[model samples]
Target: MARPNSSPKASISPQKKNSSSPREADFDIQQELSRLQEVIYESFHIPVSRWTIIDEDKVLEQLEFIGTKIPEAIRKALQVLEQKQEILANAEAYAQRIIQQAQEEAAEILDESGIIQQAQHEANQIRQQVQSECEAIQAQTMAEIEQQRQMANGEVEQIYRKSVSEAQQIQEGADEYADAVLTRLEQELGEMLGVVRNGRQQLYNHSAQRQTNNSGKQLSEG
Candidate 1:
């Protein structure tokens, strides 16, 4: 027996439904860079006489990963910018078409031989109406373009600020960690020095006692 036909909707892939939208796919490159910075900061060890130690290979690996992601983010942003430009271009083209059509209609009305005054008045009215419509369209288009531009700028600024804040936090955490490590190291070194000094004092006393005993034996023998 022949099987029934499947619906068109049923043939759609599930992956497409789960995929992220264009706006959602636009990632913050600065944030990713900041995360890389944080990782590097966290990996660093306390400075030893002006030299801080870290895993160079691991840091390089993290930087490479970030490098791979940056281009993708930049591409997404460029795509968004292109989309905005296309929208503006389309709007301007539509406005031009409307204005051209209005002008043609007005010219046709003015070309009529009989009822010249009526034709002239009607043409003037048409011109006024088309001018107002053109102005309105231009204003609306400009508004939309400005709004989109502001939104894009705001998004970029927000990303930059967030990255800066994250970087600052990473720096603070690393500084605190280094300070703690250094403090512990200093305490340990101080204890070691104290132990060495005590050992030297003990050795000096023992040597002096031995010298005095030898001197007493020599005097008694004489």
Candidate 2:
């Protein structure tokens, strides 16, 4: 059988037509997700704390743009990520500045024991970690640095107390040694005095005996 001259026209999908958007894919989960992230970034963060500070109105307005025409929204999301990177870079610079300041202060505390030097070394290590994981670092940065500072201070206190105790023990031991030596010297001097007294008594007794013998002989001669 012969088909009709007018064939059924191919129906085009409206969804397919829009899929070729220059910026946003028609149903891109990634684009939607990025838009959501941008919205959040535009909504909440602290400036002084070295993080984002987003506006609520802007957050809501941008969120409304999701699932619809999202080309502009995705662009903004990319911008937000870049801004985050910039903020992170600024934070790293600030951290380095603080480290330099701390190093200068730590120099005064470091001595022959090098206890504070160890603390500074650990601080530098922390700074390195921050640099390595900058994208992931957050509020915990302050806490970590503070904890290290407290630990350093505690170590210094412990070293000081230990040093004082050892010094006192040394002084006490020296005093005891001196006392023992003096006691021995006194005993030896007493023994020498006794020997001198015995020798004097023997000499006196001999002289008296000799005088008596001489007197007796003279009497016999008379």
Candidate 3:
């Protein structure tokens, strides 16, 4: 047997039943308007700075829909904003760090400069001291050399005088020896002359005696 048209036993689809509900239809329309208002506020900071849940059930439905299917451009815009904030923060921190490092390096350079200046001063003092000592040694050596030369000159003068005196004495002794030899030779010549004269006188006397004896013999014989 076919069911009557007026029978209440006929079943409807779940989708159709939901569409027919007045409460559900009103909730869907109101949710769409709330979501539109939310978008406007986010874009322009309009209506107020504080967030308000004007239509709770409606806003909840729209938020759920956005979570599942948001437009690509909106998502991209939000990501760019977040990236820009992070970049600014990093730039600030890096600038502060660079400034601190520069300050430290400057301090170190100043300290090193002071140390170099001190070393230069000390080195200059030492050089001056060494120069003074060298000059003093040179002067002392020159003085000592002069003294030695003076002493040597005095000794040479004394030796020269002594040699002159000794030479004069030796010359006088040689002259006296020459005079003594001449006197002895003159005495020897006088003795030799006397002996020759005596020999001539003897020869004459013998001749005279021979002649007298010959004359006497001749007379007697006659």
Candidate 4:
């Protein structure tokens, strides 16, 4: 009997399970609601007393527990709603920025169009002024030649030839001036068109860049 001592068995305690997380708590609430609904539907009806017999105390306890969790659940829901609102706000802001940029670009294009119109108007005015001056000079020269012819009938042929030569010179000068002004106007118009084209190209490039950036952002988010 004394030869072998009995080995003592070690007692093991059960580990306490971890409490439910907020997500689990929410799931529990849903389950409880469903169960409460079912219990209500299955409750015994007392026709005589017109009263339903169910586990009132148990239902009240469950309801009390659910009530305690309601504020936390509502708070979480509100947080989600706020996050969605923030995303919507950001999208709206981006849209506004795009609209503003488009408006600015349109304004710039309109300004360029206005400048071109003004240049053309000025060119036309210059042409009209030049034509008027040429006409006035021709008329004055003709008048002077008529006066000289009447004053010296003896030198009529010589005076006629000189007047014709002066008229030809005046005509050539007017033609050369008109040609120079037209050429200058053409060059200016070409330069202005080139500037407008360059501006449009730059705007297109900027828009493409913004689209690329937006696509990259969406891909990253996905």
- Highest TM-score model number: 4
lDDT of 2 at 84: 36
Candidate 3: segments with Cα more than 4 A from true spot = 1-159, 218-222
Q: Give me candidate 3's TM-score against the actual structure.
A: 0.25
lDDT of 4 by residue, 15-89 (tens): 323355543433344455655555554566556554566767667876786667655544443333234323333
Between prediction 3 and prediction 4, the one with superior TM-score is 4
Residue-by-residue lDDT tens digits, candidate 1, 82-114: 343344344445544544554464345434333
lDDT for every model?
0.48, 0.47, 0.40, 0.51
Ranking 1 against 4 by lDDT, winner? 4
Q: Which prediction has the highest lDDT against the true structure?
A: 4
Clashing pairs in 3: none
The residue ranges of model 1 lying beyond 4 angstroms of the native Cα positions read 1-26, 44-48, 107-222
Candidates sorted by lDDT, descending order?
A: 4, 1, 2, 3
Question: Worst 10-residue stretch by lDDT in candidate 2?
Answer: 1-10
lDDT of 3: 0.40
Model 2, 1-222: lDDT tens digits are: 111222222232112223447443443434544554544443444444545555556556645655354444334333332343344556566656655665565455343233455656655775676466554543443443344335444453333324334435534543453344335434533443344455556666888999999999999999
Q: What's the best-to-worst order under TM-score?
A: 4, 1, 2, 3
TM-scores for candidates 1 onward, in order: 0.36, 0.29, 0.25, 0.37
- Give the higher-lDDT candidate: 1 or 3: 1
The clash number for model 4 is 0
Tell me model 2's lDDT, rounded to 2 decimals: 0.47
lDDT of 1 at 131: 48
